[model samples]
Target chain A: MLVIEDLHVKVGDREVLKGLNLEIKSGETFILFGPNGSGKTSLLMTLMGFSGYKVVKGKIIFKGKDITNLPVYERARMGIGMSFQRPPTIHGLKTRDLVQMCAKYAQNKEIDVLNLAKKVNFLDFLDRDINSGFSGGEIKRSELLQLMAQQPDLLLFDEPESGVDLENMALIGKIVKNLLRGNGESPRPDVPMKELKKIRQVSGLIITHTGYILDYVNADRGQVLMNGQLCCEGRPRDILEHISKFGYKECVRCLNK
Target chain B: MSEQIKIDRFKLEGMEVEQDLQQFVSKYKEELEMAGIVVNELERSGTYLHLNQNPLQCKSHQSGLEILDIKDALSKYDGLPDYYWKAVDKNKDEYTKLAASKVHGGYFIRVSKNVKIKDPVQSCLFIKDENVGQSVHNIVVVEEGAEVHIITGCATSHKVKSALHLGISEFFLKKGAKLTFTMVHNWGEQVEVRPRTVGILEQDAVFQSNYILLKPVKIVQSFPVVYLNGSGAVARFNSILVATPGSYINSGNKIVLNAPNTRGEIISRAITTGGEIIAPGVIEANNVPAKGHLECKGLILNDGVIHAIPELKGTRSGVELSHEAAVGKIAQEEIEYLMARGLDEDEATSTIVRGFMNVDIMGLPLKLKQAIDKIIAETEKDMF
Candidate 1:
């Protein structure tokens, strides 16, 4: 549901992404593997239309509309959502209030915020200040809770497994898979699996340094990003195996080839 | 810099008083409601209404609570031998001197020992005559092992402008007593306000003070101080201030911890759209094992100024004191974070400002809290 062509982004006098091209269709999940400072977050930020990540030469098409220069709120309203890695803490703004705000544009106007928060185990933090003194895993769950309320057509995740423990990782992985599959923990018991998968259409673009998320999500395709360029493409499991065996240094050979 | 108010421009006396409570409530209902006074409806333990230079109405519905005019209380108790002008000095400033020279009218509320008053005592100091100068001296005393709450509202009539209000308030809390005092100010655009206040707490006494100012005024300057004199006593101060165009507010709070095991905290939030605000706070700890903290924050929306000054002092080696102060505009990161949730810039900004001015921490009554929320919402509309 999103397309980028020859995207070149600059962040404060330094070019971070160069000649990047990618496309994801409806009902598809794309996994991006990258090293440090390899422009993974830059791509997600540019896609979401954040300020300070200037698009020097590029065009973005989302759902058949050019949104390269749209404001952040307009893009969000047009069904593009992002989960930040380190979100800012807003004092006196309760988590419940934010979730309600996110649900403002949803098709389902009446959303049960407390019930949605229960799925992510964030009921205790509903009345607390958003993202204040939250642990790493708690931040992830809070983000997921907000995304559930948003129900956007496209989701951009930035390292969902960065600071999660083993137990929390399993819970987060299952939720992420459900979000991408468009079922959200509720599947019809009468419909066949194939039929159910055909009725739901949601797209995801996930960035990960570690392939620990492969065990949960059915990622359709995977690609490697190194030095501001996409170098390799293959099955997510196969790409993980190749990188684990030889490290990201072997990606340069693929780039040269 | 702020505009100067000439004391000679206002009249000190000769204003008529409306002796009927129903007539007074019907005349200035909106203004009184804005100042958190619900006349003839709310279940208040006592009610006191003071017009310029006159005590129009004073009565107490609940037993064990006495509400009288300050002048009557003075003569009744032989100048209130233990309470009148005990905590606050009469010669501290020009406003205090004016209030001392001619005590127009104020409330004198006292709760009997070991009696817990359920409903709050409501009082209103109103000015309805043009160019009238009103001076008042208020005193509240909570006896030993007693509990009470007082809501004091000060306002000027809609048609009355160019008035000066000078107020002097003193509070005394005995051993193991609890007192919660809330004051709301809703003055006219040309009115100038000056209030001097001080409070003293005994052993195991708890005192909480909440002050709110949402309406526009020419100038407002006050710095209230409280002292913890006995061990295990606690004190807290919370203030929310907003200044519109042509308004100038200079206010703060100070707490002095004198006994061991005493604690104090001061927190203030201010916003200036096109006016000026100077917020200063201080806390001093003199005994060992005492602790105090002060926090002052301000936000400037348009072409205005906000100055925050926080100070802390410790006299002994084991005393702990700290302070934090910040004055600036809203951070862009906070705005963008909210924008990413699908709200436009204006909506997101107003939301953030609403949170910044949240009064939930004040623990006010539900009706008063709702009234203040409505006022904040109306004020936000003018900011944009």
Candidate 2:
């Protein structure tokens, strides 16, 4: 479980996330819908402990502990995984190798590198650098592989469906859904049953604009994030349908009232 | 004589190099030869020297490439250095540029245009004789559109008091050409190395140089210069100098972009445990549309010293020039990032350092690119 209590976050000189509050519980998926630069990514980065975002006020609690000052990897170690909207291209690190490294980190044991490559359908690309020269779809799939490998208790996705095309959209969705539904961050080496679940066990906080993900991923709740604050919360399908009809204008009315 | 007195001869006559340089080669043959560990033989294309070491593959000198043998390589530059071809050689008896010796220590190398060499040419410099000094000049000219990779390695184990290496290299990059140079030095604890290098670039040419070290040297000073005399020229210098115990690596690089749209990059990295490291470099971007950037990163693995001073002088307002120099211990957050992933502190340190160095070394020969990767990995290994 994770909680953001009235957090005020500043990215360098600008106060990006002004007095924001949100929560996500185990076995539930929370979706944060926002326009571009609506502080969605900033919130995600702050919660993930990226360096630049200074928490001027409020606290971020993950698994009942305050991690306001924790670094990104430390938070990642504490069962928190993130899918960057635009993942950086690391030229010499193979996508498959990075996935295996993440998996090994999660399992505390060697995860066969080739197996991870095949799992992401990247066996042919096992020699290519991480995200370097990758198609957008391949990058999205690669991120899904890392998320699955990490098997975090709380998975935060930033624009998961943004760049992927129809060719890889379904596969990415399926993998994302599986990661959300999986337990223990990694499949147990001996116990195969733990991976047999029809739905993922991960608690997720997803940020999106297109709402296309609502088709494959089940969202328990949807919140409107506008101008750095959560304006409203409701069921996923209802909130998505309203946005499709009028846009953030409906949220603006609620903000005015 | 019970004393250790060093002697150096600057410019010898048109003498036989193989015989004249015999004493210098014999002195440190054993030690310099040990610097090589085998690497993938499949990539033996560059100028390289590998010591036969077990466990770790000997330094992969050759990248499985078909080179015009040294006989052929030395044959092209048959007499005196080239100018706009006007020569002022001291002797006409010099048969070729390879035969020309106007300086203390010199070399002649030629790379044909559009020819992509597979392995790095190797140079193993070892100084074992205590009282004698070695002065050699080198001239390397890469013709238009030709490409080559070169690696020079040093090894010395004998506890000799004084020996010197005065090497000068002139690189001529013809139009649209490329040359990659890598040097790995591990001198004896008390030896002096003075090397001067300069490269002249023609239109649309590129030059990349990487100088990495892990030994505690006595006095290693080099002023490597790159003159961009043509349009759209590019140059990058990467150095990772680790000074252990009593050592001094005074390294510097100068880039002057005279032609329009030229660019240069200088990067100096050092890991000091003791002694002093002074990395002072400058980039002069005088022409419009030219760009130059200098970055220096230093890691004090323990105690000791380093002054990483990067200076940039951009006279042309249309030119873009920037310099950043950072000297500090390993970041705690970076360490914790590796530790959380289950690597020990040293492993994490090495991993981060290697990651910092893992910038794409792609254009190099397979062996050299692999050697760079392997040695970087080796540097991560714990050394007490």
Candidate 3:
């Protein structure tokens, strides 16, 4: 569903991602494990087409169309959605309004907003400003709530379980699982079950630091990104176990040989 | 036999142009409608097209809101009400004197004791004749333990170039009473407006004032004051203004805490595309155990200038007062954040601008709040 070929990225005169290549098939969930200062975020941002993340030399193909030069909003409309690791607090923009905007892009635009908010335990925060004064767990849930509302064909999650606590992690895990499986709740009762299932089962590229999300979604494969390079393609669990026992340096060392 | 008197003694230091009244009305019907005023009630002079046209067009009787023409109210009581000219002096400025000497048309609203008026009393002061000043004096009295909301819109037609509007508003809130007043203005590019307003809050009374000026005008100067005279009284002032190119706006507000345990807050948000804006405010804490906060923020959308001068004065030792002021462009990060959510660049910029203008209109009725939101949305469409 998504392809990245020799994607080179720069941030303020410094090349962050140097000739990185990755691909994920339709309905597949791919995991990316990288240490701090790696080019994981750079790849996600470049894919989303944020300004200043200059694509030095690369092309991102999604759904058989090249989108390396599209604006952020055009990319979003083309069924590409992302969850920021640290979403900024927006003053005077209600969380409910943002969620409604997301719903405008979803295939199932008639989702129950109140119920969706309740799924992330954010029923009372619907009227509050977006991410303003929110706890780390609340921020993650808010991002996930928007992503679920959008229901994009290709989802990009940056550090989904980074700052979330254990209690919220369970709920986040359950919701993320539902989102991937195409079973998100909808207010419309007229949609057929088959179509709903087809609409919900979306492909995603997830970035993780500690592999805590591995307990939730089934990953088809995982890759380690180090020093602006992708190496060591293997089972997500096995790669996570290796990195937990031995640091990223050991993984890089073993992969190079 | 009574004689019809025409007062023209007050004049500003500027020239006024001539315009056709009928053409002016036809050109500004949309603006008058946007302010939620009935088209039939609009008139060139102090006369209603329909005698039975209610000022509160939407369910006024059910909410127990009494709306009366200022002339009729004055005639019925044999004179102006006691609260008239009580908050704001009649001889404060040339504009106030102009309003008092020849008050063409205004509204008198009174909420009885312990009654809550759900619907806002809507009034519109529209100018259809050029070179003619529309001077009005309004008075509102909310009795003890009562609550009410008042919305007033003022505008002039684009055809009516170089007109003047002098408005004087006085409000009196008795003990334990609350009043929320919202005023919206949309003037032509060659009009000048000077409004003089003041409010007095009794013990435990609450007062809120919201002002929005979205359209361009030749010049506008206003400084509304509030006096927290009784213990535990509270006052809040919120304003949102946009200055188009070649327009000049000087808006300020003042609040005085005369009793202990009083609270006051002043917030002003201004956006200048190519005009000049001077936003100045002051808060005075005269008694012990008083608290006040002031915030002034301005956004320069183009090569315009904005001066935000907020002053805080505390005369007593037990009083706390602070102020924060800033003038700059809209944050690029906010724009990008919204753009990532599927809004285009223009949509994103306009969304952030709209958010900046929604400056915490607290304690407004739901209907009034919705109306204000609609006005903001419509005005922003013309702005960007």
Candidate 1 lDDT (Cα, 0 to 1): 0.89
DockQ of 3: 0.49
Candidate 2 on A1-257: residue-level lDDT in tens?
88899999998889998898888887689989978888999888788776778999999999899999876666877888887766655434566656666765574345666665566687777677666687777777777767666667788888888878876777677777777776333445665754544234568998888887877787899899989878878997888888889888988888889
DockQ of 2: 0.12
Provide TM-scores for the models. 0.97, 0.65, 0.85
Per-prediction CA RMSD (Å): 1.6, 8.5, 6.3
Q: Candidate 1: which stretches are off by over 4 Å? A: A183-189, A192-195, B2-4
- Which residue pairs in candidate 3 collide? A182-A200, A182-A201
Question: Compared with the true structure, what per-residue lDDT tens digits does model 1 show for residues A1-257?
Answer: 89999999999999999989999999899999979999999999899888899999979999999999999999888888888899888887899999999989866657899998988889999999999999999999999888888888898999999899999999899888888877373577998777876765789999987888888898999999898899789898888898888898879988888
Number of the candidate with higher TM-score, 1 or 2: 1
Ranking by lDDT: 1, 3, 2
Q: What DockQ was computed for model 1?
A: 0.80
Q: Is candidate 2 or candidate 3 better by TM-score?
A: 3
Most accurate candidate by DockQ: 1
TM-score of 1: 0.97
- The list of candidate 3 runs beyond 4 A from truth reads A184-201, A252-257, B1-31, B38-84, B89-91, B97-102, B359-374
iRMS for model 3? 1.2
Assess candidate 3 and give its TM-score to the true structure. 0.85
Q: How many residue pairs collide in each prediction?
A: 0, 57, 2
